[model samples]
Target: MTSHQLTAGICSRLNEPEHSDELLSSTPIVQILSVKRVGSTNGPNPIDRYRIIVSDGEHFLQSMLATQLNHFVDDGKINKNTICRLDKFTCNMVQEKRLLIVLAVTVLEQSTTKIGSPVGLQNPPGDAVASPATAQQTPAANALSTTSTAPAVSSSTTTTPAAVRGQGARSGRGPNIFPIEGLSPYQNNWTIRARVTNKSEIKTWSNQRGEGKLFNVTFMDESGEIRGTAFNMVADALYDKLEEGKVYFISKAKVNLAKKQFNNVANEYELGLEKNTEVEECRDSSNFPVVRYNFIDLAKLQDMAKDALCDVIAIVKEIGDATEFTSKFGKTSLKRELTVVDRSGFSVRLTLWAKNAEKFTHTDQPVVALKGVKVGDFGGRNLTMTSSSSLEVNPDIPESHALRGWFDAGGNSENFQSHTNAFSGGGAVAFNRAEMMSLEEVKVKELGGSDKTDYFSTKATVMHLKPENIAYPACPTQGCSKKVFDQHDGWRCEKCDRSFEKPEYRYASTTVTAGCASADPVSSRYMISMAVSDYSGQAWFQGFNDLGEVLFKRPANELVAIRDRDEAKFTKLVEDVTGQQFNFSCRAKQDTYNETTRTRYGVQKILPLDYAEEARHLMELLAAPWAQ
Candidate 1:
């Protein structure tokens, strides 16, 4: 029979002054006496620094297990009485007491029974009493309250381990909670006490990596906020327990770099919970922080990066009727547009989707506070609600109250800069809102000289209309608007490579209007080949089939039939539109036709005259310093 000898090398020599510094730089074999998890304070995501007591049968010393080594305890490989060989360590003097930091360690022997008791009683420097060898191994039951005068190796810069533990013991309220900003992938042993700010529905996915059920949670503390995900068994365990707005004491979650594309939280790191993760509700979480928003002013939204999450506080000046549409997946999606204004004297469009759109109620133009809304651009800057986003209607926050006060004090009546009409959707035409240029000034500016078209609004009376070629056959494809050739059988579109049994008819009208009575002979007539007019001047405007039909309040096919069947009726219709005042949005571009270089003005959009908006524009013009 071979006798087994359990020997502690440097662990026994730890008390010796000479061996201490030398062994601290090198690896040493020791017997583990006990290990305890100490909670962190200061940040929401706090890494737990393990207080480990080791013995060599002759002497005992205290050390801290690096957070990276948390897996050892989690795997049940570093229990009391287990023998381990430290591969790397650092010794730092904290609060005048020397503490050993275990950077790396390997199990030498696994044991469930107790090891030898404390050999000789020697207090660690600055300690009043020596740690008892027979102390209970369970951290919760027999954990000693130890304060760190200094930080552990590679610990967070803002806080120290001993201080956290000491505070917990002295205050009896537990350790200082950590904020989300303090979290990083470099540490693992941490506990986060955070309020669940946002929660996502369970989602399942399968690929080459396999399939599993997962859910996400957004949490925040005083310092910052972060997003976390739990998959498979961990998700099943914690899903029902996670309630939005509830604070929880969570530990043992793995931290990783956040995937910027998917995560909207400002934190650089996110959390992943595993089977060993601990989650306990913090009932007395009055101290826990609520989610904070760093709102971007409404005027600054246009300059921000596209798709960025935006926090904004604004007054709901206008709300569009909710519209329902079927997505490509056949899912019904509801959308509504809201015009929100802020103190910056600017207004932007916010698109609400799904429940936010359907459940929205307009009451007294309540203040709309948004967090984590996705920025969008159609014609100009717009916003969309994301799953992780939240909307507060007339929230009692300071910003909301301030906006309410501002709006009530005649703020909405002020001339607000508008970013929505800056450009038209998917068109080359840009929006011209403030300045009403004369026909000569439009040509001088060469509005549509560039690749993109320039847009301007004008008030003018229609002088004449070229009723010929007023309506044309178009391809019936939903998005394709190419002209189709009328065939005996049907209509064919070269671009679409398909023939339609029945072609959709569209109106493209070329109407001429005079800018001013005293304008130049040739350029005075503002030729709006299509689109609206106000009182400014006539410009060449062209309106497409849909817009033309909208203006005529009749379908293109019906109009075309009337034109073909009754010349007198068509003439009356054309004559009725002529000499009428209208507000028109016109697109200008230069084109060469049969050796003739001409600037063509096309009508892209038409808006019914808003007496208030026109009055505002006129007021702005009158208030201009140049005008004075």
Candidate 2:
């Protein structure tokens, strides 16, 4: 490499907007003097950012590498003494210093020695450097100039607020458009030009502190993406203005630490819209980037733990009819189940809730891309879309187009393996047959001792039942099973805000239970604690309504009535099931109460002894070479 290969003094020319077109017409090549990692690794955004000192042969300037281009640094493609062409970049003033944001670069050649004796650019003679206070008074300096005629302000020259505002207005953007990846709580007077990729419905919440409404929207630029939220009055004002896939110039919003539990955007900082926040739609947004997804294959879902969030793109193999169900809290909700398959030859059920469920009408096997869908383990493995999740039907992305092509060309005829068990959690144990554990093996292996819950199956005989507190008087509401207070006149349910003449009796579980899906408003249920033992050891397990019915062959309400009217019959009923053996699907979870941590086992499903299946399994085991 020689000095002539570098674009000498191009760094100085970038500061002068009058030469933007001339510079844009020809690519500027520069030498990488050095590269250094910046940003806090312990911060909410732990991703590494690189800052490089690039030389135009005559003068050296500090440049920040766009996060999207970090691969160049990591892959050693661009390094010290390497010459590269600056494909796209912008100049910005930060804290009274000129900073170059390198958006795109192309590596040309590598050299072992420096190409030129480049000196650092200093303020021109007699020019006054802007003070920190003066810097704060101006708009962000990263905004790209729309035209070559836009006046340029040197970082060393102090300008009045009016002039800075005028320049921004003349450029048609309120301020310099900051990249979403560069946003932080420390920056002030910065604006971002980005497209809204997704918007959520306004959600209202009530708690001890009162009630408020809020909504979230995801914004994406060429650099990266971030989540923005508006609350209460602000939410009401901006909810209608931020439409999906529209570009806008947003300013005056506060950047805060992201709440990782609520969102899946890669960026670490999120924006909070305030009353004074400015959001102006940009009509000329043809250059804005569309939504990006980090999709995972369906076959890999088995390796992911429950409650993990993932992005996926697959063909809609089947769609179930929308069904209405009352939630445990008495809210009526609608849901639809979708069987989606990918080229990985695996299928998983994707559940859409509320409006998304009711509005889906696609039947032509459209390719759907979902971001932030949660993985579940209710039966085996499934997916559920939450408030932060976004869905696109027949997206134009390369992945979607590839999946569509594959499906149309005989991929639909391929048999895909399902992750879920068809009969699991309904009336029998999982048909997939989870790893069977003995009571003693479960204890020895320390299952459910971790932060996440552990599930397994076992065969155990019922030993005894804890007779006390087996049933409680519950509200008669269709969905609510909360305990009701018996006033002398009537049963009162605080949650329902109503009173009834009589409280319905229900079996009480120590832990939360799902609501019944049956049509009957008032059905008998049970929540009981029973001891079960296998050949190895004995352990206590919590049984809910379904398990209770399977074990006792009767409803909890009848047992409670029998216990009250005839103690002898209830005692006999309990004793009759004591020695019965069955297959149990159970979950173990550790909980802390009063600083005491203990593991609790809950029965998720129960299955009777299948003599024929058992015999076949035994025969297969005996025929094994090791057994022979």
Candidate 3:
């Protein structure tokens, strides 16, 4: 850090001789380094803190400097010297070695820094003391220039104040700057120097209503990276002015809290440049912090959900679709998924979004730096990236090239990720597809067919099969699925209190069990058989009155006998439709007394006649085929 880096301010106080005498005698000397007026988060306070990296050439000056600095003020708007006590000093040790420097009141802690006024420095107590409070408001150096007209005096002629000079004013303090580099807690203004790493190509957007530009840039520092955006007018200039790898000073940027649900970037916050922000291209880059992360551990990623922001790096394994999507803000975006595996025997899925996604897909193979990717969970959980995120592909980084060759040359580190089901809070139970059937009690192979070729086992139902090709008259009442009329010679309904010869359509189910010994998913075929026939065919179905008399009476044991009558035909019919043999299954409702399915269809059938258009639409979807 150079002294020129420190700014000079307007200090028109030394003009007063009395004020000058008090300043030079009471306060210790100082040399300012850097000054910044920062806004405070608490209350409405602002601070004008100076990074006064100080050193004392004389042993006596050390205690005096401490006493003065402890009383320094940081009220952003207060331009007066508020150096009250030198005891409240703070320092910290930095890993890098740096020269210990000292800071004095350079007058830069005020509005701006420019060496324009030598006369202003000559004046002591620019603003005369209205009362005793002004006594402490003046810087001691102002005394030298305060009495320009008085008899010129040097330190040899001056007498020290009543307080001891070098007897250690602060308690337990050590050999100050020798043991440290900077202050601890390192509190400073949001000062950053970043490079415009890949500025977005300038593009204009205009519509019938409005037009604007959405320009973006990636930012990198020693700590890691983040992204920033300029919308509309602001974007125009930045898009043209900002160049890649060029450092720039940034301030007054609006911080963006990342949308964790959408982005896969690791930063807690993204940022957008506000209209009032100050952005200047800096000539120096050495002072900028280089962004980096040690990559704590990869195994922890297994527990993270998709769309989580994280910093991860590993060699590429496979890439997926480079499909495009529209963002919620109406901007166009693209995405692609990749499988990234590391030495931890874990392969995490990475979803790259937008331009990065496109770039990754186009690259043949690149060892990448996925610094701020967000983890997400779509159909499957994985990592994603947002605009605030940054990516480096095949950069000249050691971790990148090394990981690439390490995984490529016979590394068992390429092991696929383990699923949550594989290892639970309990433990892992190793089993393959072959052993799954036995464990699940399922039959895999099917029975052979006629011509003795081969056969398949399905589980379908014997729905609507009559006792011996049966017949029955249905009830005439509306909205009733129950079979009301049951007669040997004539017709009568005991429930509806009506004599009936005509019948209404009702839900009549098939009676058959369907399942494989293992999984019982699709074997039965259920009401789908009836639905397919009634849905596409011209045949009207029998009402529930007929179903109750024929199929529902016998238990499943008795119904199996019919399978033997024409085993080939039965086997072929089941095999043709489901491609599996029928098994044990019955289609029963939650309530038997309700005559449920029949009642449902009964009411549904009448709606079309009564409500016409609505009924027609309802009838279109609410049928057996739809039921299937």
Best by lDDT: 2
- Which of the predicted structures, 2 or 3, would earn the higher lDDT when compared with the native? 2
- Residue 386 Cα positional deviation in candidate 2, in Å, after optimal superposition: 3.2
TM-score comparison, 1 vs 3, better candidate: 1
Q: Write the candidate numbers in order of decreasing lDDT.
A: 2, 1, 3
Model 3 per-residue lDDT at 416: 71
Best by TM-score: 2
Model 2 stretches astray by more than 4 angstroms: 2-4, 14-26, 38-47, 119-168, 171-175, 303-309, 325-332, 376-378, 420-628
Worst 10 residues of 3 by lDDT: 599-608
**Models ranked on TM-score:** 2, 1, 3
Residues 125-171, candidate 3, lDDT per residue (tens digit)? Answer: 33322222322123432121111010011112111221111111122
> Model 2 over residues 167-219: C-alpha lDDT tens digits?
44665655365666566665676877777877888888877999999999988
TM-score computed on alpha carbons, candidate 2:
0.59
Better lDDT candidate (1, 3): 1
